[model samples]
Target: MMREILINLPIESHEVPNLRELVGWDGRHSDYPTLFERCNFWAGLRVEKNNELIAFGYVAGMGLQHGYMEDIIVHPQYQKKGIGQSLVKKLLQESERVGLEIVTLTYDSKHASFYNESGFKPCSGGLWRKKD
Candidate 1:
């Protein structure tokens, strides 16, 4: 049977828990509501098999000139199925449509080839996290 994969669907605040769980991120679900509300641009994909959310991802950013892609994840069982690539491409398209000059994302070194294949080049930058 063919599954249904919806791209760039409207994201509801209730979906945040599933997204965080899929990516194995530890954070308060409450934090996502406000964060998503403030995003300049965002896109989400939902891969549904019999109405279940099997795979998902999204990119959120703050500025018109530079957009950051985030939480691009395909469920462990669904990796290597091109879902991540499609999700990223969808967000990039949206970013460009909104006049964004650059779309940026950070990923682990192990995933470099995937992003490279998706047309991302190695670039230098720095990151600093605030102490909590």
Candidate 2:
């Protein structure tokens, strides 16, 4: 039997390590803290079994019209279990709740099918990275 998954917001800072592990990110990095500080809305999903954090995602809004989904990840063990879809759906709902007219997320081409199934469509965009 599969364990129930619970999704909630206002996640505690102590859970960052688990999230880093889930996404293979460096726990020592301050990116997670910055995300919590900067994101307009965020959510995390936990497995009820051991109360382990198995998924996380966040959204940031530019005014009330555009929302960007960021840092979506699910533990490899939890992939293909609908956890990712649930996370995306939760972010979309939050975006709608805030009156966002457009929602966007960036993902690798290999993951296009997943986002496409979740109602995302192909669109052209550009990115510019500032040099350190």
Per-prediction TM-score to the true structure, in the order listed: 0.80, 0.83
Instruction: Report, for every candidate in turn, its global Cα lDDT versus the true structure.
Output: 0.68, 0.76
Error of 2 at 123 (Å): 0.5
Q: Backbone clashes per model, in order?
A: 0, 0
> What is the lDDT for 92 in model 2?
85
Residue pairs that clash (backbone atoms under 3 angstroms), model 1? none
Candidate 2 lDDT over residue span 1-132, tens digit each: 334333345566767656676577766455656667777877777676677667778788664798888778788887898888988888887778779889888989999999999999999999889999
**Residue lDDT tens for model 1, 1-132:** 325445445666657567567668653578666766666655554555454454555556666588777767666666787877876777777778788888888889999999998889999999899999
* Candidate 2 overall lDDT versus native: 0.76
Evaluate model 1: give its lDDT.
Answer: 0.68
Residue pairs in collision within model 2 = none
Candidate 1 wrong stretches, greater than 4 Å: 1-8
